[model samples]
Target: MTIVETTSEVEAVVRDTLAVHQSFFLATSGSAGPWVNGAYFAETGLFTLSLVLEQRGRSLAAIRDNPVVSVIISTGSPTEPFLQAQATARIVEDAEADEVRRVLLAKVPQVEPFLGTPVAAVELRVLSWRATDIPNGWLPGRDLYDTSIPVAREHRG
Candidate 1:
């Protein structure tokens, strides 16, 4: 296996991981202490992940106290590696809520009934990410939006 070392390579890995997975683990902390929960999520571009969370849930309460979070997107197979990300989360409101709902429902339609009542939209702005396993070794976490490294592009003749 070739080592993934470039920014584009990292982006490709992240994009591919998100494409195949619908749910991820969210870790948060608050006055009540730390908590981790699984949540269905949808991605917008490469750095933003969205979810509809129950307003009264522990995860939401943690977010209310501390917006920082860590997320894990896994293939669920014991042998496969997982993607880990650190993010800043916030509640989505007004027009943005509608868009969040649309994106989420497109990925997980069963969540429709939970839209407004006790559930609300939250967006996680990714700060950095790393993969559990890469070709050479574990890939170290890097800026979520880093575009400094050059990526090889294919040119069609």
Candidate 2:
């Protein structure tokens, strides 16, 4: 199989993968060191991911101290691998918290109980991502970021 390398190609894969995955692994670091946690997420537009975190978790604390974070999302298909994204995290302001929570609930209803607890609404701005399709080397892998290639329209319609 041919490898996908163009910016649009990579974006398409990333979009598709994100569409099929509701949860991802979030990695963060703070003065105490590094932490990784699984979180249920919701996506807005093509590049933003939103999630709610307990106000006092290590991951949340790390994000408060440093916004840089990484997220890994899988396509949820046995045939596909995972997508690793490097992103910047930001706490949603009170003005937008309700809307963010609404979106998150729509995607993951199980989070309802946790919502009652004090939590922070966070948004992850994707900076770059990578995916590998190396099933015995049948297809080459691709690693790309926002600056890896010039942004271009994906469709003419």
Candidate 3:
């Protein structure tokens, strides 16, 4: 296993993980209670993913009430590395659906057949992430990235 040190390396690991994984488990909670479901995703940007969700699905309803969510992307192999992320989600605007649709199909062509169905494009903005591989082990704080933190503090001398 390659040593995953440094923020850039961690980011690369995340991008690589997202690129190879076609689906992830999304967990959400709202009035309907907690719900976890498999969702096909496409990385639309740095720390961002897009999905086409059924309009009336419980997942969508939960997301509508509570945008906060968590996702796990993994093959469930102990030796293989996997990432877990906390993200905020939102339903894409109608004007943006076409672009999201194009991007989604580019990465997940299998979704093409469902594009015409009654579904809405959802975007997930990942807040933080951590990668864990039982074989490689974790470096605690070094292995986690949180976007909410300021990269650098302004120095007033």
lDDT of each: 0.78, 0.78, 0.80
Worst 10 residues of 2 by lDDT: 148-157
**What does candidate 3's lDDT look like per residue over 60-88, in tens digits?**
99999999999999998757778887788
Q: Rank the candidates by TM-score, best first.
A: 3, 1, 2
Candidate 2 residues 19-75, lDDT tens each?
778889999999889999999999985668899998989999999899999988865
Candidate 2's C-alpha lDDT?
A: 0.78
Clashing pairs in 2: none
Across 31-68, the per-residue lDDT of candidate 1 in tens digits comes to: 89999999889998687898988889999999999999
**Candidate achieving the largest TM-score:** 3
The deviation in Å at residue 56 for candidate 1 is: 0.7
- Candidate 1 error regions (>4 Å): 1-5, 134-157
Answer with 2 or 3, whichever has the higher lDDT: 3
Residue pairs with colliding backbones in model 1 are none
Report the candidate with higher lDDT, 1 versus 3: 3
Hey, what RMSD does candidate 3 come out at? 4.6
